[model samples]
Target: MVEFAALTYGLLASVILSAAQRNSKMARPHPPLLLYLGYLLCGLSAGAALGLGYIILTRFIGH
Candidate 1:
Protein backbone atom coordinates (compact mmCIF):
# COMPACT_ATOMS: atom_id res chain seq x y z
CA MET A 1 0.00 0.00 0.00
CA VAL A 2 1.16 3.52 -0.72
CA GLU A 3 1.85 5.71 2.28
CA PHE A 4 0.71 9.22 3.00
CA ALA A 5 3.95 10.83 1.95
CA ALA A 6 3.91 9.14 -1.44
CA LEU A 7 0.32 10.15 -2.09
CA THR A 8 1.05 13.71 -1.03
CA TYR A 9 4.08 13.92 -3.27
CA GLY A 10 2.15 12.51 -6.23
CA LEU A 11 -0.72 14.95 -5.74
CA LEU A 12 1.58 17.93 -5.36
CA ALA A 13 3.62 16.98 -8.40
CA SER A 14 0.45 16.47 -10.45
CA VAL A 15 -0.90 19.88 -9.52
CA ILE A 16 2.37 21.60 -10.32
CA LEU A 17 2.77 19.86 -13.65
CA SER A 18 -0.81 20.61 -14.66
CA ALA A 19 -0.44 24.26 -13.83
CA ALA A 20 2.82 24.49 -15.70
CA GLN A 21 1.31 22.86 -18.73
CA ARG A 22 -1.61 25.28 -18.69
CA ASN A 23 0.57 28.36 -18.37
CA SER A 24 2.84 27.31 -21.19
CA LYS A 25 2.10 28.47 -24.78
CA MET A 26 3.56 25.42 -26.47
CA ALA A 27 1.48 23.27 -28.79
CA ARG A 28 2.80 20.13 -27.15
CA PRO A 29 -0.04 20.34 -24.66
CA HIS A 30 -2.67 20.60 -27.34
CA PRO A 31 -4.71 17.65 -26.12
CA PRO A 32 -6.11 18.03 -22.62
CA LEU A 33 -6.47 14.27 -22.26
CA LEU A 34 -2.77 13.86 -22.92
CA LEU A 35 -1.99 16.29 -20.15
CA TYR A 36 -4.23 14.37 -17.78
CA LEU A 37 -2.63 11.12 -18.85
CA GLY A 38 0.76 12.64 -18.26
CA TYR A 39 -0.34 13.61 -14.78
CA LEU A 40 -1.44 10.06 -14.07
CA LEU A 41 1.85 8.69 -15.31
CA CYS A 42 3.85 11.25 -13.40
CA GLY A 43 1.94 10.70 -10.18
CA LEU A 44 2.40 6.96 -10.41
CA SER A 45 6.10 7.35 -11.09
CA ALA A 46 6.64 9.89 -8.35
CA GLY A 47 4.71 7.80 -5.85
CA ALA A 48 6.71 4.71 -6.74
CA ALA A 49 9.97 6.61 -6.48
CA LEU A 50 9.06 8.08 -3.12
CA GLY A 51 8.00 4.70 -1.78
CA LEU A 52 11.22 3.05 -2.94
CA GLY A 53 13.36 5.88 -1.63
CA TYR A 54 11.67 5.67 1.73
CA ILE A 55 12.21 1.93 1.89
CA ILE A 56 15.88 2.28 1.01
CA LEU A 57 16.37 5.02 3.53
CA THR A 58 14.68 3.17 6.39
CA ARG A 59 16.04 -0.28 5.61
CA PHE A 60 19.61 0.46 4.60
CA ILE A 61 20.49 4.01 5.56
CA GLY A 62 18.83 3.87 8.95
CA HIS A 63 16.32 6.62 8.57
Candidate 2:
Protein backbone atom coordinates (compact mmCIF):
# COMPACT_ATOMS: atom_id res chain seq x y z
CA MET A 1 0.00 0.00 0.00
CA VAL A 2 2.79 2.41 0.75
CA GLU A 3 4.48 1.70 -2.53
CA PHE A 4 1.26 2.19 -4.42
CA ALA A 5 0.55 5.44 -2.64
CA ALA A 6 4.06 6.68 -3.32
CA LEU A 7 3.82 6.07 -7.04
CA THR A 8 0.43 7.67 -7.28
CA TYR A 9 1.61 10.70 -5.38
CA GLY A 10 4.74 10.90 -7.51
CA LEU A 11 2.82 10.80 -10.77
CA LEU A 12 0.39 13.40 -9.55
CA ALA A 13 3.20 15.66 -8.47
CA SER A 14 4.97 15.25 -11.78
CA VAL A 15 1.91 16.19 -13.80
CA ILE A 16 1.04 19.19 -11.69
CA LEU A 17 4.58 20.53 -11.63
CA SER A 18 5.04 19.96 -15.34
CA ALA A 19 1.87 21.85 -16.16
CA ALA A 20 2.90 24.72 -13.95
CA GLN A 21 6.29 24.86 -15.62
CA ARG A 22 4.71 24.90 -19.04
CA ASN A 23 2.35 27.70 -18.16
CA SER A 24 4.99 29.81 -16.49
CA LYS A 25 7.02 29.98 -19.70
CA MET A 26 4.24 30.87 -22.09
CA ALA A 27 5.76 34.23 -22.92
CA ARG A 28 9.18 32.76 -23.64
CA PRO A 29 7.91 30.01 -25.89
CA HIS A 30 7.71 26.30 -25.10
CA PRO A 31 10.65 24.55 -23.51
CA PRO A 32 12.51 21.56 -24.86
CA LEU A 33 11.93 17.97 -23.85
CA LEU A 34 14.91 17.96 -21.55
CA LEU A 35 13.43 20.72 -19.43
CA TYR A 36 10.29 18.70 -18.96
CA LEU A 37 12.37 15.78 -17.81
CA GLY A 38 14.05 18.04 -15.30
CA TYR A 39 10.70 19.10 -13.95
CA LEU A 40 9.71 15.46 -13.60
CA LEU A 41 12.88 14.76 -11.71
CA CYS A 42 12.07 17.52 -9.29
CA GLY A 43 8.61 16.13 -8.72
CA LEU A 44 9.87 12.60 -8.17
CA SER A 45 12.39 13.85 -5.63
CA ALA A 46 9.66 15.70 -3.77
CA GLY A 47 7.47 12.61 -3.78
CA ALA A 48 10.30 10.48 -2.47
CA ALA A 49 10.80 12.92 0.36
CA LEU A 50 7.11 12.94 1.13
CA GLY A 51 6.92 9.17 1.08
CA LEU A 52 9.88 8.81 3.37
CA GLY A 53 8.42 11.34 5.78
CA TYR A 54 5.11 9.52 5.77
CA ILE A 55 6.81 6.23 6.50
CA ILE A 56 8.77 7.63 9.42
CA LEU A 57 5.73 9.36 10.85
CA THR A 58 3.58 6.28 10.64
CA ARG A 59 6.24 4.04 12.13
CA PHE A 60 6.69 6.19 15.21
CA ILE A 61 3.02 6.92 15.70
CA GLY A 62 1.89 3.35 15.17
CA HIS A 63 4.45 1.98 17.60
Candidate 3:
Protein backbone atom coordinates (compact mmCIF):
# COMPACT_ATOMS: atom_id res chain seq x y z
CA MET A 1 0.00 0.00 0.00
CA VAL A 2 2.79 2.35 0.88
CA GLU A 3 4.66 1.56 -2.30
CA PHE A 4 1.53 2.01 -4.36
CA ALA A 5 0.74 5.34 -2.79
CA ALA A 6 4.32 6.53 -3.18
CA LEU A 7 4.61 5.63 -6.84
CA THR A 8 1.23 7.03 -7.72
CA TYR A 9 1.80 10.32 -5.97
CA GLY A 10 5.35 10.57 -7.25
CA LEU A 11 4.28 10.10 -10.85
CA LEU A 12 1.46 12.56 -10.44
CA ALA A 13 3.76 15.15 -8.97
CA SER A 14 6.32 14.72 -11.73
CA VAL A 15 3.71 15.09 -14.45
CA ILE A 16 2.29 18.22 -12.92
CA LEU A 17 5.71 19.71 -12.38
CA SER A 18 6.74 19.06 -15.96
CA ALA A 19 3.54 20.51 -17.32
CA ALA A 20 3.92 23.63 -15.22
CA GLN A 21 7.48 24.10 -16.35
CA ARG A 22 6.53 23.76 -19.98
CA ASN A 23 3.71 26.27 -19.68
CA SER A 24 5.64 28.87 -17.76
CA LYS A 25 6.86 32.00 -19.57
CA MET A 26 10.21 32.67 -18.02
CA ALA A 27 12.69 35.26 -19.28
CA ARG A 28 15.64 32.97 -18.68
CA PRO A 29 15.93 29.21 -18.93
CA HIS A 30 16.72 27.19 -15.85
CA PRO A 31 19.63 24.77 -15.90
CA PRO A 32 18.74 21.21 -16.82
CA LEU A 33 20.44 19.85 -13.71
CA LEU A 34 18.51 22.25 -11.51
CA LEU A 35 15.19 21.31 -13.13
CA TYR A 36 15.94 17.63 -12.75
CA LEU A 37 16.83 18.08 -9.11
CA GLY A 38 13.65 20.07 -8.49
CA TYR A 39 11.55 17.32 -10.05
CA LEU A 40 13.34 14.69 -8.03
CA LEU A 41 12.82 16.56 -4.79
CA CYS A 42 9.19 17.31 -5.53
CA GLY A 43 8.40 13.71 -6.44
CA LEU A 44 10.18 12.34 -3.40
CA SER A 45 8.51 14.77 -1.04
CA ALA A 46 5.06 14.13 -2.47
CA GLY A 47 5.59 10.38 -2.40
CA ALA A 48 6.80 10.43 1.16
CA ALA A 49 3.93 12.59 2.30
CA LEU A 50 1.32 10.34 0.70
CA GLY A 51 3.02 7.18 1.96
CA LEU A 52 3.12 8.55 5.51
CA GLY A 53 -0.48 9.64 5.32
CA TYR A 54 -1.53 6.19 4.18
CA ILE A 55 0.35 4.61 7.08
CA ILE A 56 -1.23 6.94 9.59
CA LEU A 57 -4.71 6.46 8.17
CA THR A 58 -4.38 2.70 8.25
CA ARG A 59 -3.21 2.79 11.84
CA PHE A 60 -6.05 5.02 12.91
CA ILE A 61 -8.60 2.89 11.09
CA GLY A 62 -7.06 -0.29 12.54
CA HIS A 63 -6.71 -1.87 9.15
Candidate 4:
Protein backbone atom coordinates (compact mmCIF):
# COMPACT_ATOMS: atom_id res chain seq x y z
CA MET A 1 0.00 0.00 0.00
CA VAL A 2 2.76 2.43 0.91
CA GLU A 3 4.76 1.48 -2.12
CA PHE A 4 1.73 2.18 -4.27
CA ALA A 5 1.25 5.63 -2.80
CA ALA A 6 4.91 6.48 -3.15
CA LEU A 7 5.04 5.28 -6.72
CA THR A 8 1.83 7.10 -7.59
CA TYR A 9 3.10 10.39 -6.17
CA GLY A 10 6.45 9.96 -7.87
CA LEU A 11 4.79 9.31 -11.23
CA LEU A 12 2.54 12.30 -10.77
CA ALA A 13 5.56 14.47 -10.05
CA SER A 14 7.27 13.24 -13.17
CA VAL A 15 4.23 13.93 -15.31
CA ILE A 16 3.93 17.42 -13.88
CA LEU A 17 7.55 18.13 -14.67
CA SER A 18 7.30 16.81 -18.19
CA ALA A 19 4.24 18.88 -18.92
CA ALA A 20 5.78 21.99 -17.42
CA GLN A 21 8.92 21.50 -19.44
CA ARG A 22 6.87 21.47 -22.61
CA ASN A 23 5.18 24.79 -21.82
CA SER A 24 6.52 28.26 -21.00
CA LYS A 25 3.85 29.42 -18.55
CA MET A 26 4.40 26.77 -15.91
CA ALA A 27 7.02 27.87 -13.41
CA ARG A 28 9.61 25.18 -13.11
CA PRO A 29 9.60 23.60 -9.69
CA HIS A 30 12.80 23.09 -7.76
CA PRO A 31 14.19 19.75 -8.79
CA PRO A 32 13.26 16.73 -6.61
CA LEU A 33 10.72 18.82 -4.72
CA LEU A 34 7.59 16.66 -4.62
CA LEU A 35 9.60 13.66 -3.49
CA TYR A 36 10.57 15.61 -0.41
CA LEU A 37 6.93 16.45 0.20
CA GLY A 38 6.00 12.78 -0.03
CA TYR A 39 8.73 11.82 2.39
CA LEU A 40 7.61 14.52 4.81
CA LEU A 41 4.07 13.18 4.64
CA CYS A 42 5.26 9.67 5.45
CA GLY A 43 7.28 11.00 8.39
CA LEU A 44 4.33 12.95 9.69
CA SER A 45 2.18 9.83 9.55
CA ALA A 46 4.75 7.87 11.52
CA GLY A 47 5.01 10.66 14.08
CA ALA A 48 1.26 10.73 14.44
CA ALA A 49 1.22 6.99 15.04
CA LEU A 50 3.90 7.35 17.69
CA GLY A 51 1.93 10.09 19.42
CA LEU A 52 -1.21 8.00 19.37
CA GLY A 53 0.65 5.05 20.80
CA TYR A 54 2.00 7.18 23.63
CA ILE A 55 -1.46 8.42 24.45
CA ILE A 56 -2.88 4.93 24.54
CA LEU A 57 -0.04 3.61 26.65
CA THR A 58 -0.31 6.45 29.15
CA ARG A 59 -4.06 5.92 29.49
CA PHE A 60 -3.57 2.23 30.16
CA ILE A 61 -0.77 2.88 32.63
CA GLY A 62 -2.74 5.44 34.61
CA HIS A 63 -5.48 2.98 35.55
lDDT of 1 by residue, 22-46 (tens): 7575644446765676677777789
Error of 3 at 38 (Å): 0.3
| lDDT (10s digit) by residue, model 3, range 1-63 | 989987987777676667557757564576686578677777778987999899999999885
In order, the Cα lDDT scores of the candidates are 0.73, 0.75, 0.75, 0.69
lDDT of 2: 0.75
Model 1 clash count equals: 0
State candidate 4's TM-score. 0.49
Write one digit per residue (lDDT tens) for candidate 4, span 7-47: 97677657655655655355655456655754665676698
- Alpha-carbon runs more than 4 Å astray in model 4: 1-31
Candidate 2 versus truth, CA RMSD in Å, comes to 8.1
Alpha-carbon error at 52 in model 1, in Å?
A: 0.2
Task: Give one clash count per candidate, in the order shown.
Answer: 0, 0, 0, 0
List runs of model 3 lying over 4 Å from the truth: 1-26
**Model 1 poorest 10 in a row by lDDT:** 25-34
User: RMSD, model 1, all Cα superposed?
Assistant: 8.6
